[model samples]
Target: MKVSTHQPSGLSAPGLPSPSLFSSLLFSPSLFRPYLWLAAALVASPLLFSSPALAHHFADLGQMKPTLSNGVLSGLAHPLLGPDHLLFLLALSLVALQCRWGWALGLLLVGLLGGAAGLAWPGLPGAEALVACTLVVEALVLLRRLPPVLLLPAIALHGYVLSVPVFGWSTMPVAAYGAGLLLSQGSLLLVALWLLRPIAKRLSPANLRWLALALAACGTTWAFSAWAG
Candidate 1:
């Protein structure tokens, strides 16, 4: 025994012409309810993933809070937990993937050392501002398909930025910290390379402008906030 069910028009069966065929006859909004509902659901799903907010790269492990290990190793590893530092480093590593491995590694090492040295001797100003700006500038290059370069001077400058301790972690011996920092930053480089592989394939020339605009916007917002206080 077959039960007669009222399937939505185009979804119906047997002699009833396809819904679009009777478009003139069935012009009611109710006839399009299923598709409208599907579209609404599709749009809303992304918003659902949007809430509670995804954590930043280094955010989950109490990163912003100071590490209390009270030793040189801990001091070197402190930046690992700071989301700002992690994100910037990760972005640098990933974006640098466009260049040769030697250049990429050299740039990162130089930047890392420069950051360390800046802290070892605090003569320069605006280290934080420069770090923030670096991210913004790098994003523009990413959008433009430009190669990432680590000029010697810029590497020296990054060291200055990393030296800025949010509070009083500045008393640690700077030289002793370099070895530990090398290890820490190396991990960042590895992860960045791994993640960028897929992105390299998926990115397209046409989207570069929009991507740059979005990155620049993110960088500007972050830089403005860093500058504000």
Candidate 2:
């Protein structure tokens, strides 16, 4: 019997890439194609619109009746009004995409409900810093530089921070508001996750890294503004 030695084209003679080569391929920008556009958009949005600069202070909205309309409107408006809230939501979606959606999404709901339940409790101090830190941590998690397990606690904290503004509302209003927020945020997250799932199939690891970097930049800017103000 004759022994044949052959290697596949475009592969090393060993039939596997060397560590350095693999790392290079992983970090190469060309790997991230269509999705890079999204990172660019995230970077550009704040510059294009001035609305995000305004801090959302839902807590100060004065008294509201326990009506369904008010609850839904408040729920819809809160996430839209606060850039911080939006940032946190974006981070949550990203984590859900990276990890198991069922687990991540479930924890997100639990956190939100827990937060709403604690509405009567005093608001957390240093909320701005906490939010900024959460964004930063989430970006790191997305980059694969942090453990996925930490995400649960971070997301839970985010829920608390997000709910703080509307905590003092009456029971019916708070319940209704929580429902609205869940609907709005859940819809936004589902859409984003669905869109990204397809793109992820074609994306290189580098693309995810770039996306994380973009998120980090946004988080940094948000943190600075929050701390400054």
Candidate 3:
């Protein structure tokens, strides 16, 4: 007697999906759509977080008398509130992930010094434009089109911009502002590095390139606005 070779219709082997169903699930474009959305959100987050106002001051500390409390608060808020500054710090953190701890510390020190210099010599010409340029440089670094060392000057420019509001504060308030700025920026770097380490490990190089390109576009737009305005 001849045996039937075909399996029953509409039935898969026990504990296994049908071959057609498995292939459809595997190749379905919808399967990866959520990740695409997540990436888009990540790329657009800088614009979303940034304000339309050009001023970075969250409390208008520049116009008021600078006290130790407000000084510190202003210092802490500047980096977080300013899109250009925040994006630079994030890009720096990404570079830091690949470099030695000593390098990161050195950059931080340089930034602090830059802030001090800003206070000493306030109203550096084109300071805002310089800060915007740094963002583009940082994006290039992330894309591996530039060396990580290039981030140093960019960071120093950021430090200078960060001190712009606190330029005329008294000695004590200035010190407090510096301290708060250091604390906030350092914490941001450390936290970002910690969080990105795992995610960076999992993401492909192509994904990172896309992120870097997005940052570059943002930087370019910011730079144009700064120069034009």
Candidate 4:
């Protein structure tokens, strides 16, 4: 009798991927289609939903009474709901990912102060324009064309715009609203910092530069649309 030596032709070892399986996953165009669609949707969202009216009135506070509960709810929802505000914060987070923690915190503190100032002095002229312009300034900062220190005034303007809805509320409600804003915006920044830290470290300068240019284009378009409308 002759002994035969043979092995399975296509079997991979335990806990290891087969070459075919790995290649399919790595080289499959379908695998990346969903990601492409998602990116397109994200890029188109602001154009589809953004408007001057929606920018400041996202929380439907028009008829709501100024109460602690309403203020808190409004504050929490305002930034998340408004496309302009959301975009600004997202851009700010990306920018912050490249900066020192102290600078980021200082921006947050300055934003809080700006909110307080807004409550005291509502209806800052060209405030909407200013808010829109902040995005452009942030993009410049991201590109290293402008200093990070410039973010301070831009964030302050954002705070002022954020507080516009809470204007004329009583002290208690106003305080509650401010707390909510701090909680919401602060949490957003912190989370962005944590999540993006690794990605930021790995990003090439060219990639970051492209991101900055995209942000600048978005900001410029939004600002122009606001002015036109």
Q: What is the lDDT of residue 115 in candidate 1?
A: 62
Residues 1-229 of candidate 3: C-alpha lDDT, one tens digit per residue? 9988996664456876444453343335786756767876886675744432365555464465788998788778777878787777787777777777457757877888888888788888777777777877887887778898887777887777777777777899888888888888888888676656655655578877887887777777777777777
lDDT of 1 by residue, 89-186 (tens): 66566456666656666765776667667556765654555555665676766664444553345545655555554223434444344445566777
lDDT of 1 at 53: 12
Candidate 3 has a TM-score of 0.77
Spell out the clash pairs found in candidate 4: none
The estimated TM-scores of all candidates read 0.57, 0.71, 0.77, 0.79
Candidate order by TM-score, highest to lowest?
Answer: 4, 3, 2, 1
- RMSDs, each prediction? 14.3, 9.9, 10.8, 8.3
Q: Which pairs of residues clash in candidate 1, taking residues 3 or more apart in a chain or in different chains? A: 114-159, 115-159
Q: On lDDT, who's better, 2 or 4?
A: 4
Which candidate gets the maximum TM-score versus the true structure? Answer: 4
Name model 1 segments beyond 4 Å from true: 1-72, 145-147, 150-155, 165-173, 206-211
Candidate 4 overall Cα lDDT vs. reference? 0.74
Q: What is the C-alpha lDDT of each candidate?
A: 0.53, 0.66, 0.73, 0.74
Which residues of candidate 4, in runs, are more than 4 Å off?
1-30, 37-44, 47-49
Cα error of candidate 4 at position 222, Å: 1.4
**lDDT comparison, 1 vs 2, better candidate:** 2
Q: What lDDT does model 3 reach?
A: 0.73
Q: Alpha carbon lDDT of residue 156, candidate 3?
A: 80
